[model samples]
Target: MKAALVNRKMGLFLALAGILALAVAWWVEHVLHIMPCELCLVERWPWRILILIGVVDILLPGAAGGPVLWLAVPVLLTSIGLAACHVGVEWQWWPSPLPGCHAPHISGHTMAERLASMPLLPSKPCDAPTYLIPDLPISMSMMGGLYAAGILVAFCVWKYRVAHTARRIFY
Candidate 1:
């Protein structure tokens, strides 16, 4: 026997979770003024996708039982990958994959040309990690991984039975 769920309710829950994740990141970045590295920004992409899926599923009744739920697995996986990469960079286990991580590109021949071409603010280095709480060993990327894992687990628990039913119906 399996417990039944309204797909729309599940979708709404997921959408709200997505929004809260982004909100936390934004709060840290904007209100707390903690800068993010390239990988940190990349980690948010999956959450953004999830938010979109959730919102769409909520608005369109037909979308709930469609392909939206299955997409969560891949998006969560992507988030995990991004966070792991960031963690590696933070720990000096490996170098960041981004070219800009090496250094900002200065193509200009002269110092003046380079200065003129440069933006007002340079991006934060990916090698360095920011801790949200003082004196804490955990880095932001690790927190992101934790967040992703929590949401993924919750999502799996929420939709496990429904997914099988969906597969049976579709295939």
Candidate 2:
């Protein structure tokens, strides 16, 4: 019916949203050569989960898919929380939760000992925010938080419409 078609369309939209966010992140990191902090890397997990759930919902029957998409609500919330944490770190409101977000301090008396204690890989500090544009005044994490909030609002509206229509159909 019409409802099923709408559900499938929303599922596709949600899947594409996740894909777009990840794609931008990849492009920023690979194409632009901007390194991501540990917290930035951590924030992507919710999107990945959303992508999986959205794809599953798209594959399922319309009625069944609705509930699956509901699972994305919490995941989106988590993403928002992660983004806020990142923003806070960037603004110096608080330190990052991840140890990797901070530069490791190598303590040693001898040169050989200091060299041995140094980390093998380079890491970007979470407090240093990456701006996508020159002097944009908005960090990537802030933009991500806003994007997640928008998606959450859209999903809520979709669910509300579906529920209202169901009431009219049943009652």
TM-score to true structure, per model: 0.84, 0.92
Q: Evaluate all candidate structures by whole-model CA lDDT and list the values in order.
A: 0.81, 0.89
Best model per TM-score = 2
Model 2: per-residue Cα lDDT over 41-153, one tens digit each: 99988888888888887888377886788888999999999999999999999999999988899989999999999989789899999988887989999999999999999
Worst 10 residues of 2 by lDDT: 61-70
lDDT per residue as tens, model 1, 124-160 = 8898998888899998889888888998998887677
Candidate 1, 118: how far from true, in Å? 3.3
**Candidate 1: global Cα-lDDT?**
0.81
Q: Note the clash tally of each candidate.
A: 0, 0
Best by lDDT: 2
Question: Clash pairs of candidate 2?
Answer: none
RMSD of 2: 1.7
